[model samples]
Target: MTDPNAPVTVTPADDMPASSAKAVQALALKHLYIAWVRFQRRPESMRSFIGYDLLYFPPPYAAKWAKPFGYIRQAASTIAAIRRHKPDVLWFQSPPTFFAHLLVAYRALGGRRLKVVADCHNMGLDPDVPGNFWMKIPGTIPALNSFDVVIAHNAAVGAKAAGLGVRSDRLLVLETRPAPLPVDETAGDPVPQVILVPCSYHDDEPIEMLMEVAARVPDATFKLTGNLARAQSKNYPARAPANVQFTGYLSAEAYTHLLTNCSLVIGLTTGEGIQLSGANEAVGAGRPMVLSDTQLLRSLFGDAALFAANETAPMAAAVQDALSRQGELRQASRTLKDKRERRWRLQAEACLERLVP
Candidate 1:
């Protein structure tokens, strides 16, 4: 049984076993990363290169009324973890931007000499723009501006932080690289599969358009992953082709199996300046991809994925093209993984340099 009193630390990424220990020893900085959420692959993978000891504190209760109490417990636990670890560099995942506010208060009141950094996601960077009332609380921007360094997913997100008064040099652009899930040893499904990962069922994703694509390609199975309720609440199609299947809310094991066995992974979004976690997953698994054609996606994916417009015809065409050239696109994905991993190392190292005295 896991000990409730003990501090929870992240295990090293399977792909980069030496990353945490080696980087910490070479840099001579003890780094500790804290998050209020259950789990996120971005921080998990980033810790592999950045060598930060991860401390995850998932909320204690599910009830909405208990959130305030949950935040109080989380704040106390965060302070306890920091005191126990005594890291020279403290990194916090913001949007719970209040955690950063708490850290700043902790430094001011407690007079701790720790170098504070924030890994700001899009919502955290601009809560006002997203209009997420819970996150658009007072001091959101000021707390963000107070961080010693801000790690952004891309230059576009970093610019938002800068506009809010964070110093330019202190803002670092570091994209997410999802760690691959371990595929089962058993044989894959006999029918060819194409996965479409729409995690949030947001406005930008063309959920209805997927039905059109599935109709066009009747031979290959089309599986969509994420919450069924959210999809249904949105403009999701009531009826899809026989080949279209919704693998709603998959277990980690099932998700890994489905992603690994699929011939192609398609994650299309019209949202500007956002990076797709699904695209990163495709790269991690070395699966062929069909992604939306946007500046951010095109820049990050390059020749690795088939780019398509959000319309039915173009998306269907791209899906077909990726399915036909699975072998070639799979190899390209592997190659892209290598190139991105190398780039991530440099980017992580550069961000670390700013933390050094």
Candidate 2:
């Protein structure tokens, strides 16, 4: 197994045909991926899609007062890591879009020929921070436009970047599709179970609506995964149905087991033009899913997942529907996974051609 910390050096696959010489050449390009996120699926998945040396800087939890200091420490470490790696291409995630800006300035001032790519999440594009003037002034637009390429999750998001002055030619729409997860066939709940994976009590997640939906479906157990204390502080529903269980936070292995063995997974969000990571996890596990009804989701998922509005009644109904048709939905999910993987390959290859050429 390739070490995640080591510099990326592509070795031609044993089974790779000679005709794939161009692919081998592209994969051989040196790459270093940097991210300052606590958890993300895109960087992890990118390792398999395209080779990269992942320098993941998971910032330690800090109080609001100490957050700035935390960024300072992480920034120092990131600079050292990049200088040591000295890669041909530098790809990084943008939520604190400052990271992208920092790299752009670094490349300019240090006189390095490094090509920068910004993988902008939805929040990275539009920070949605209420009344934050900094987000509006000299925000993501300038930082994004500075990159050699900017990756968006979908065309809708790409359009947003284009509207904000990021050149269309530099934008690539690359969805995050996780690698297939190992299922624990022996692990399962005695009662019918539904797993709700939220992206940390974001405003888009309708926690109260889900709680009500759980109350409606008492026969099925509902397990919510995340930091429960954070959820509570965010004013998420304090009281839940007897069937509802807060799983605090789960380890990666435990989380995968829960998703793979669950009767259904529900990924609900009120945000427009944003894809839920939880839904991707459900797809990775080939588990049935009930996702929020939105054009972006419908277009991406097609018939693989059940759609429901964020309202309580519709969501409850969808959950019940998914539980009943678990087998059919599971098959559909597998089919969707195959289709998405093919699509991702074509897009990734096109991206590599540009980067490697």
Give the per-residue lDDT digits (tens) of candidate 2, residues 1-357. Answer: 333344443333522222345655667777888888655567766675466777767666546678788888888878888788887888888777788767767777864678787887887765442222334546567777777788888888778777777887788888886556754434433254655555467667788888899889888878888878767787553677788888877765677677778888888788778788888777777888899998989988866999999999999898888888877888888788888877776677666665655
Q: Of the candidates shown, which would achieve the greatest TM-score relative to the real structure? A: 2
The weakest ten consecutive residues by lDDT in model 2 span: 10-19
Where model 1 places Cα greater than 4 Å from the true spot, the runs are 1-27, 59-69, 126-135, 178-190, 235-244
Score residue 249 of candidate 1 by CA lDDT.
67
**Alpha-carbon lDDT, every model:** 0.74, 0.74
Model 2: which residue pairs collide?
none
1-357: candidate 1 lDDT, tens digit per residue: 343334444434423533444444434677788888755667766765556688778889766689899999999999988888998889888777678778878888974688888887776775443344535667766665676778888887677777877778778888876464543334333354656554667666777787888889888878887767666666463676788777776755667677777888888777766778888888887888898888879998976999988999999998888777877887788889878877777677667667754
Clashes of each: 0, 0
Tell me the alpha-carbon RMSD of every candidate. 4.0, 3.3
